[model samples]
Every structure is written in C-alpha cells, then in structure tokens.
Target: MLIRSSTPEALRQNNSLSVLSALRRQGALAHTDLCAQTGLASATVSAITAILERDGVIERLEQKPAGGRGRPRVLFQPKRDCGYLAAVRISSDQVQYSLVDYAGRLIDRFEEPRLGGDGATQAFGQSFLAALARLAERSRLARDQVLAISISSKGIVDPGAARLVWSPVFGGAALDFSALLGAVWPARVLLANESLLVAQAIAAQREGQGHIPAIAALSLGHSIGLGLARRDRHGEWEVSAPNFGHMQHVAGGSLCRCGSQGCVEAYAGFYAVLRTAFQVPPQTIPAKFVPIAEIDKIAAQARAGHRMAIYAFRQAGQSLGAGLARMMSLFGSMPVAVTGPGLRFFGLMQEGLLEAFAETHEGRLNGVPLILPMTGEDELVFEGHVTRALAEMDVMLATGQGGGAP
Candidate 1:
C-alpha cells in the first residue's frame, strides 16, 4: 500500500521499461504493436525507439511485402551485441555459470564442482572470479562488456548490497559479491535467492499470458525455499524470497544444519524425509546430501504401503502444508507452484499435504489455493536470472542512450 506513483524521472524510467518489457515479452514488435503493448502513444514509442536505435540498443527489422508491393513493415528488436550478462547459480554440489546476450539468448555455460567447505569461503570466491573470467573470455567478450552479473544461490541474499548473508553451504561465512567483482569488472552485481529468481521468471511468463494476481513458488529439495511474486499496480514485478526452510515449525523438534531446532526444513526437506524414513534420531546431525535414488526407493516403498515410508512422506507433507498455511494466513490466498527436484515424489505427499492445509483456518476460509507441481526448476531459475539482470541493464542502456529522460 506504500507504493506510490512514479515521479518525473521515474515516469521516464517507466516509459523506457514499458517499451523494453514489450519487446522482451512479445518479441520484435512493430511500432503499432509496440504502442498497444506499452499503452503509449505512437509519437512516444517512436521517440523511445529512435533513441534506442540511435544508441545501438535496438535495431529495425524490415519485413518485405509478399508481392514486393507498397511499403515494407518495420519492426524493432533488441540488438544482440549491445550488451551481455552473466548468471551464476551456486548450488550445494556445484556452481553453474551461463552467459547471455542482450537478446536473452544463452551464449555459453559451464559448471564447476563446489569444493569441500573446509574453510572454503575465500577460496571459493577466488575460483568463482576466475570462472567469470573464463566465462567472458570463452565468449570473446571483455570483462567490462558484460553489463551485469547476476548470482543466485540457495540461501540468504542481500539484494541491495549484493551479498550472500547465510547459506547452507558456507553457513556464517558471508560473501560480498560487489567487493569480489569490483576489481576485475566495471559491471554491476546482483545477488538474489534462487527461488526468488524462479518467481520472477514465472511472474513474467504469467504476465505475458495474462494478468496474475499473485503466486508463490516453493522449492523442495535438499532444502525448502519460498518466493512470492506479484505485479504491482504500476505493472512492475515485486518479488521476495523468505527463509521459509529455516522458519520454526515445531519448537524443540528435529535438528537443522543451521544450528536451529524444529525448522520447516528439518521436516520437509529431502534430508528430513530420509531421516524420517530411516527413523533416525531427531538429534543426529543431518546428512549433507541424500541421493535422489534413495528417495525414489523410499517413495516406491511408500507406494507399496510400507508403514515407515508412508509415515515419513506424510509427515513431510503435513509439516510443509502447515508452514504454507501459516504463510497464507499472513498474506492473502494465492496459487502455489511447487517446483524443484521434489516434484518427483509429490504423489506420495499430496494427501497429507492437502489434509494439513484443510485443517488450517486460512485453508477453511480460502478453500486451499491451487497447488501445482512444476518441473524444470533449473530452466526457470536461469530464465529468472537473465530476466532480472537484463531488465536492469535495459534501464541503464535506455537512460544512457537518452531514451528515459525527456
């Protein structure tokens, strides 16, 4: 509700962003379609597009008539070589790096195994910077040519300062990305929670299809992560990733890696399901990794009516549902998209998950928002990183090119 109208400069930014957003969503729009998409006048679109073209940020595509008659229709699209972006996704076992062009096309990508956390913070930072250099060099681009670097990880991220505050891998060793990238490149740095990127990508996709009130993207895997994304009145996306995994579920219950007891991750995470399936003592240190094969076995057993496996999956679902219900109670009702590797086993947990939701007062009032199982978390996550980074880059280029300000 604190959201306010854009001021003079902000209005200009909105105008530029609307044009860029239209091109990004609909792809290579003619001036007429561009006006309709951005809800701007033809003159405004022409002015902005002209500035964009003059600054080499966009190019005009000519469509020849079928019979070579009359005039050719012209279209505007982002110039692929105008800028570049890098996306780094840090996971528990490995780090993935992808280079994308201004047109949101992938140029290059690779992965590096994450070394053991035997005092691995600074060392990992070194390797990551080197990887960035490799990413640029292999793509034949100078460091400065990469306009932005977007880093996503499964932990706490300070988007304002571009820092990794808390992560399952590094624990208390926080990494400030701006400081790390400051020396080698002049590009801006952005750090965001992995699930947050997923939400952004999904939000953009939904907006392209039509209006979406709000949605929550829940990641279930080695850990539980939650992200909420909504389009505000201004048609700008608002996204946030809460540390839903570590949030307390049952006080003084199972031990969590973050030194917390009774966190939601302690019950619903993959490790939690494994622990429950094996009836491991709640106080034991959680496993760093649980192979999906083991979970598959457990799921198979649960499907065969194995008592312990059934109970384990049911427990995970109920705990997850309770935490989500609490979230819905705080926020308004919204559809939930369950993503990540955990979707493979959702069939085992849907019953208990729904039952627990139905028990909540919020669920009773709202009638349990739609719970959809979404596959390909990786695709959405990468798409999100590019979408966010490129959007910011668009603002930078458009303003620098004299397109934002009147």
Candidate 2:
C-alpha cells in the first residue's frame, strides 16, 4: 500500500500526488515536464512515477520524437482502472450518479426518478443510496476503492457542516446527507451545490490560462444558478458568492415553486420557459411537463425554426439577460459562461440577450468581457462533481495523506 505511518510514506504520498496532478493537468507529461510543473527534483519524480506505475495508478505512453537534439522522452498518463470516484447530482426531478475515472472521464452513468415535494426526503435518500450501490456493484468498484464521493445538489451546501443549508427545491431546512450516507458507506465525502461545482470545474479547466479573473458561469435548468471566480493576491483561484440565484428579478412576473414571485428562475427556469412556450393554462399544466418533456419539445421546435418556438426562447433569453445585467453590475462584468439547458436557445436569444445586456450597461467594468454562452451536456454538473472529488484527492495526497482508505 502507498500509505504508511512512517515519514518515508508521507514523502512518497506527497511526491506521488504531485506527479499525478501534473499528468492530470497537462496530459501525458514527460519526466522533465513533471519536474518542472511540480518543482520537484528529477530523481524524486522518477521514484514517485515508479511507485505509482507499480501500483497501477499511472502508465507511460509511447515516447514523442525529439524536438531538436536529445533522446525522445516518454510521456505518462493516469491509469483509468486504478480506482474510481462517484459523482451524484440531485435535483428536484431526478438524481444522477456516475462512475468517473482518475482522468475525470465518466465511464458509466445511472439516474433514478426523484420523489417530489416535502415527502421526497426519505424516498429520494433511499433511492439515491440504492442507485449508488447498484452502480458500484455493476462497475466492480469496492467501497474502499472509491477514493471519495462528491455530491452536487440544487441548493446551498455547508460542506464544513456537511449539511445543505437551504435549497429552494428542498425548502429552507438543511438536509444532512453526510450523517445519512455515513451509515451506509464509509468514505471521505464532500457536498456542494451543483452550480458551485460547475464553476470549480470551469475554473480548473481555465486555470493558468490568464482568464481566471474574468471567468463566470451561469447554470440554466429548473432554476438559474451562478458561480463566479476571482484571483487572490497569491494568484490562486477563489470562488465567490456561489448561491446567487434567489435574488428577485421580476416584481410581479410569476409565483415560484418556493412561493416567491418575480425571481429570475420564475421566468427563465426550465419549467418557466416551458410554461411560457406551451402557453399552457397554469391550472392545466401537468407535473411532467414542467421540467422535462415540455422544455425538450420546445428545444426541438426552436431548432426546427418554429415561429412561436423561436419567440418563446427569445423571451426567455431576454429575461435571462435582464437578470444577468443586474448580476454583472453588482459582481462587476466578466466573461460569463451560460451553460445547462438554457444554451439550447442561445441562437434564439443570442442577439436579444446581448442587446438587453448592452442596453443596461453604462460602461465596461474592469474591462471584463460580456457573457460567453457555452453549449454542452447536462451531465456537466456530474463532471464537475468528479473533477472536484479528484482535485480534493489530489490535495490530500499532496499533503501526505496518500489516498485515504476510507
């Protein structure tokens, strides 16, 4: 085992973590590259790599041709089978779980229907655990081999306390999943809001790219969520004010499921956009149509250039842009990444949103750029959870904990 009680083991763990992190961030790094990236001696890098390779945590790929003179250098990549982590994303309508490798690739995914309303607490908890157990069993990963488990939800999570402080979807009461899951699986667990994890993932991808200070992310789904990043004096990425969705946007737009009116989510959320697009009578709208099928149909029709569909999406974009303008003014404008289902309508709302944003801004703040829409899978939140869990593991290893056996 890589873990030991002696000082030698601590040093080994630290060195291994540095090498692993280098490979993860730079992808197939050479020995020299690892040394330079990690500020470790060449000999230390070799020793760590040797131990990691012996443990099946990393492997050397084919050597690349020499650039000019010297011998060709061998590159290393993370071994996918070494271990895996589980990423769970819980929302109002469903719970999604994935088995992700050390390289952050999701190898398998599982989702279960969510129990809605106040009665969903116990039901969702049981179903979530069962789904996780099934996924782990099917994937052949043991409980101890799960380096860590990170959960992302549509609410504010107090990680230190291991409780969800408040979730519009779960009501205001704090939901303690740590205590709940601890009884089932013994593993190092971290919990955070889906939006915050999404932001962390974005920041991790953009790290050292000179775009850290100006990067921001917006999650558009059943509810709108935002994540902002800024660089500290020490030149480290820091997340700020992750839960910024509850701010009221429309004074009299519509009543939210949380019993509030005029919030941005009330107008631009997945359900809100669907309700607006379908023109369904409020009383007649079915439960299933709110978050899934209706929004999907609208996306498909908008893609087909249906007039009403396009108009409906444009309206959603306008509402989103309006709320975003307020956020930009308060947070100082930055390069915004609009993600999630909302990006499906980026084409329909791109011009309108930009126009609305432009109409509101007086002048650029700190030369921060305008919102940059990113279109990708809804599984991004799960991906974020994986990234965060792996990063935390990397930190633990770097600090001499090896991979905790919990």
Quote model 1's TM-score: 0.94
Give all TM-scores, in the order shown.
0.94, 0.78
In angstroms, give how far residue 313 of model 1 lies from its true place.
0.6
Report the poorest 10 consecutive residues by lDDT, candidate 2. Answer: 282-291
Error of 1 at 274 (Å): 1.3
Encode model 2's per-residue lDDT on 316-379: one tens digit a residue. Answer: 6766677677877776666788887667656776766666666675333333246666766365
Q: Which ranges of candidate 1 are over 4 A from the true structure?
A: 1-14, 401-406
lDDT of each: 0.87, 0.70
Residue 132 error, candidate 1, Å: 0.5
